[model samples]
Target: MERTTLFHIFAAVLFLYNLPACLSRTSPNITTDQSALLALKSSVTLPPDHILVNNWTTTTPSSVCDWVGVTCGKLHGRVAALDLSNMGIIGTIPPHLGNLSFLVLLNITNNGFHGDLPEELVNIRRLQYMDVQFNKFSGQIPQWFGGFPNLVYLNVGNNSFSDSIPQDFGNLQKLKVLNMKFNQFTGFIPRIIFNMSLLELLNLKGNSLSGNLPANMCNHLPNLKFLDLSLNELEGQFPPGLQECSNLQVLSLLHNQFMGHIPSEIGNLTMLEKLYLGFNSLEGEIPNEFTNLVNLEILDLQSANLTGCIPSFLFNMSSLQWIELPYNNFFGSLPMNICPRPLLRVLVMAGNKVSGNIPTEIGNCTALTVIDLHENNFTGTIPEEFATIGYIAPEYGHEGLVSTNCDIYSFGIMMMEIFTRKKPTDEMFTSDLSLKRWVSEALVNGVTQAIDSRLIRQEEEHYFAEASCVSSIFELALNCTEESPENRINIKDALALLQKIRLEFQAKLSEN
Candidate 1:
């Protein structure tokens, strides 16, 4: 008629101009990938008919991205990593996850997820590792996360999230590992961790993080290594730019209210190993530059209002093992080379004023186990090589107690070093009577001669009531090492008979 009506009006304007590049701006018949997964389940908090859309039907949303733990990443094939860690997946967190702009690792760590955190995920420009730590996530940490330019590992630690930690995290220039510890985060702390130069492991320990710190924060984290600001309230001093962190190893400042005097340049931390300044208000001494902490192992300065002299270069710390310098004001006399490391284990110089004599080179330490010089002023004799060594001498043998069964032979030689892991001498030969008379002659000649054939485990099979709960905790460590301190058993009835043999060996290791 008019050239077939202008070829049916130019084929209906070329089918509405290829229908929005083949559909969906919001819904042409639904498709721009089903309206980008219903706009990512309407930005998650899902509920209404939420059977998580049963295999995302609306006719196969990108081939059901492999159901269940749904992990799918295949650029040329489609879908990208969405690891739902510990998926109990509760609400929040769903600004359509920035519509998975080719998501590259988004692990919703440890479930029960609560709100905030969705600043449209900084529009996920190819996101690179975002672990929503512990979870119940509250607000404030989202300053468009300093525009995550290929973000590298950001964990929202423990989570209850509060504010102040966003000096735009110094614009995470390819940041690496920033864990916000036990959160409730208040102010201070954001000098951009001194300027996070390729940072590595900075755990802000149980937070409430107060002032000071950050002066060069470990010389700008020169590849920082494990810095846990223990229980917080953090005050000043102490941050000697962590001696420019030459691979600093575990420096925990326990409790707080830190007073002065411990930085004799902390002997320039030669790969310092575990130095916890316990409690705090710390006063003098102890810094003979800690005899150059030669990879020192565990030196907890307990309660600290400390006064002089227990640092005989810490009895020559050849990799010293576990020495908690108790309650302070420490006077001299107990380090007769307090067992110069044959792997010395637990030598707590209790409460202090320490007057000498227990050192028979602590009976050549054969790895001493737990030696508390309880409330000291210590006089002589008990060293029948520690009456054979779990010696918590609460005024053992009183009135200058000249050893009549020395604190019941140092609690039957710390119950034969907790049942024969052995080491209690001073040469009383005669096959020894201490370790409490060989566990009452192995429970009257039978309960397998006081166990500890190195606590037996010959190809694990035995369960005679789990070997009679280790021979009833070696007869409650032979009734608390009795040499007859009025027939022993006291440190609160030997800790309620070892908590009733640890609840009968944890109810026989839960029935095998």
Candidate 2:
């Protein structure tokens, strides 16, 4: 019996010694994940009464899985995703977040988060989707981003990231959507990025990226549906191989320095819906092959120095909506039955040498909202159906020389119509009470009375900022519509002031 008691005592001692090790193996994983999340919470600066302030607590280890933006995997009970998007959280990301080994998605978009992304994020090898756009983050995109073999969607747009795009991005063979737009990135687009065959949406717009596009830019982008390189300094002839991207739907290369004939091969994109190649040095007639784009909705070739007759086929397209060929050298009469398609909305042929009487059949286009035919050689009385709405500038009545200032006057009227949602020819207006006069009087009384009610209803948080912005816009419009051409604000100055107003409005919004 003594021997049996000694055996029992020895076994109990061993059990006691191993009990702590067993508990450590089973419980430390959850404890470690909870600690990591707490560290992240402590690092961020939350807005007043933020949901995280109440929801993310350490009362229990299992409580983290119930936090606002945290998602835990059922199998392992580990955090699998962290989505703090639009939460207005500010601060540098804590390195402890790298402990989320099971994380497959991380989205912190539209916040005020600033600073370089933590290099420790390389530990989240399973991350497949990441969006950090519309923030204030700055610095070089980390090269280690290329190490995520499973990454599928990535967007770092609308931030202040600078320097050349990391060439290591080429290693993301599975990437489908890559957007780095509106940042300060400079230098040649990494050639290897074009080799991402699986890419569908590649938007590098509004950057300072310069260099001739690679000759074989579209050779491998077979799935590309949306390609926007607009507002850049990129220059060169159209890549002949772009036709290889048969699935392309929207191609926007506007406001670049490209100089050459637009390749006819562009017509091969039969699936294309919108095409914008304006504000470039490109010359020559639009390719006749463009008629093949049966799905085309918007075509913008303004300020491209293109010459020749405007194609009549452009008006006949059943799906066409906006046809912007302004500020070119096209000279010809508009098709008499100009817009047979009811979907057509905007027709801008201003600053061209086109000559003809205004088409009466344009009345058939019930959806038409904008018709900018200023600075043309059209002769004859304005169509009663077209001009009775009071859009005609004063210079037209006096046979004064047509100038860009005339267009400015019309632009002012359009802005008024857009904000007030009241046409110049509205029943409320008369010889004494014009749309401009009504808006001016309302501005003096209260700008909100002239602003669209929808704008006020939708932006309650930014009511003051919106009101101020609208007031400034109305004041600018009044300057543009001064009775005498000499008194009107010049188009260039008007544009600069409008941009300034936008910046100030954005600053106010951030403050709010």
What C-alpha lDDT does candidate 2 achieve relative to the native structure?
0.83
lDDT score of residue 315 within candidate 1: 61
Per-residue lDDT value at 113 in model 1: 82
* lDDT tens readout by residue for model 2, 57-147: 8664536666788666655666667788889888888889888887877888999888888888989998877888999999888999898
Q: Best-fitting candidate, measured by TM-score? A: 2
Model 2 residue pairs with clashes: none
Compute the lDDT of residue 333 as modeled in candidate 1: 84
Model 2 lDDT-worst window of ten: 16-25
Q: RMSD, model 2, all Cα superposed?
A: 13.0
Worst 10 residues of 1 by lDDT: 22-31
Model 2 misplacement above 4 A? 1-27, 60-62, 387-512
Candidate 1 structure lDDT: 0.67
